[model samples]
Target: MGLEFNDETFRGDYTFRNSAKAIARFPFPFAEDSYMYSVNMEPHLPGRPGSVFEHMFDVDEHYVAEMRDRAQVLAEDPLRCQSLPHMTLAGWDLLELIMESKARDYPQWFSLTKDGNRWHWINRPLQIEQSFTFLDETTLPYGPMEYITRQTQGDFTLQDQRDDNLWIEAGMVTTQADWSLDFDIGMSFHEWHAPVPLAHEMRVFDRALKFLLNLQLGAPVRRFNWTMTVDPLLDTSPENYPKWGPSKTTMTPETIGHRQHLRVELQTLHRLPRSNAIVFPIRCYLIKFEELVTVPKWARRLHRVVRDIPDELATYKGFIRNKPLMLDYLSKYDDGAPTSPGIWPE
Candidate 1:
């Protein structure tokens, strides 16, 4: 049986504080009249003037709550976080990079100190303070990747550039949007994204690998990808399909807006200073459909994109089942009247 869609009040408790600000700062996936997958990479300018490039790692109001979610997910399924043997040093590289970045950005809440090979990290928000050797896993409760992921809000993956390509060397990914880190482990760049439509036909993945390999130490690249979900869930991995799969069939015209949500992944890829591993961090944000139309611009743009989106992309995103209903709900705001049946795709 599918999950029942009740007439429930949508609460965006998991999102960052201030919806207007969140929407304003939101990395809307579509840029122009159409949407397609591509190797969209931008420089890692932390303090850039634009809304998107302002930060590489975001530490926001939901920091505590999000970290708690990650802990719970890891507790239930340890496979949610995995690091291959060779990537151990890369894990340490990521931990130090994240610690330094967070401490520098939020000096009041986060601090890091180094004494020779030993280092201490202080996370005021979580009341956590620990000291560990740079590449020593014994000093921490778990492996370097898992230990670092436990403290941060992003799902991280460390990809090593070798054999003239990038390989999934190690990663600690707890809040996977739809993909599986365990399944993707050891898969090459092209093999990992094999499911994506048009990526290979257009050579997007190969081109992206070349671009990533050439990235300098200080330069990082970022992109946005989006889909719709029925609830605010961080562990929407395929293993938990029984929990969220029923959501699509249960949705109705009345419950669509309140029950359905727009989930977007704000992803950043950077070159690790020491190990030369490419660290990819992904942060997901969820906004209710009912709340989305409140921002007239977002609602209008989303409607246009959904309506114009190709069937292949729509099917891949799981939008085929409920696209018509979502479109009708958005159409109510586009015009005073609901969308006509004729306007909907077959």
Candidate 2:
């Protein structure tokens, strides 16, 4: 059987529907009640014919909206996009990968052409057509990675393998789900993941890095990670703590369903062809718990996982302050009472 897990970006343009189909297809992360970190990587391939989801990558309905949001974020804080001097080649490689993917998958909106080392790109969505030489810094206004990130939903992280390990050498991350790319840059594979409780004890990261190192060009790997957020807005980095900080103490039993959301990150890791750097892309999705309980199975599983979650893991996830309220809210779903509006009747 394929992998299953429990798992938005906000652009008011996108509305999450609480339909049976959406609930049935939802990536529910917990295999058991409690949560713990693991490598959880799976082969990156295209989805089955006619399937709603894609295998390695997905250009969702929110693609354009999220890209607009990213452009705004970068415009407001340029530091959100960074790259070291040595990662120039890797940046170019990633730009090509992204541009090629966009042109291939979205022919109507994007197209790419090449004449020897010179290339031309037409982006209908952004309303631009430009020609430039590959690897020429002056061709693109910003670095390749930074320019490409403005057009893709996921924030990209490029890690270079050296001394038998992968070091985070560069990335363009404007809509950080929660973690900071600034702090994670230059950290070794193990060092960056040190804060994750179980992955280290279980040797998950060690095994994962080994798998990543051995990964070939055509084969990519994907995984899922999830958490809860108080709002639908995407910018939750430490810099915006003041805006979302009060939600922890302010959420009550009645408002929990509407105010809280289940935030899921679909992380895809690709081994770049030329530079051999690992290209990590994180796509964030959000669905309100109020919308989640439309499916009985999701509601029950989520309740059990939250109830059984250990204090340390919960605390690490910033659930310490609001766990009780969330649990109480979920318990009502388990008890078969529709606490929120627009309940799908059994």
Clashes of each: 1, 7
TM-score of each: 0.88, 0.86
Per-residue lDDT of model 2, residues 130-239, tens digit only? 88889998988888888777777777899998888999989877656667788888999998888887657788988988998888887887877888887666777776
lDDT of 2 at 258: 77
Per-model C-alpha lDDT, please? 0.75, 0.74
Q: Compute the lDDT of residue 276 as modeled in candidate 2.
A: 86
Tens-digit lDDT string for candidate 1 (77-174): 88888888889888888888888888887788889999987999998878999988877788998887888789887788889989888998687776
lDDT of candidate 2 at residue 200, scale 0 to 100: 78
Per-candidate RMSD vs. true structure?
6.9, 5.9
Q: What TM-score would candidate 2 get against the native?
A: 0.86
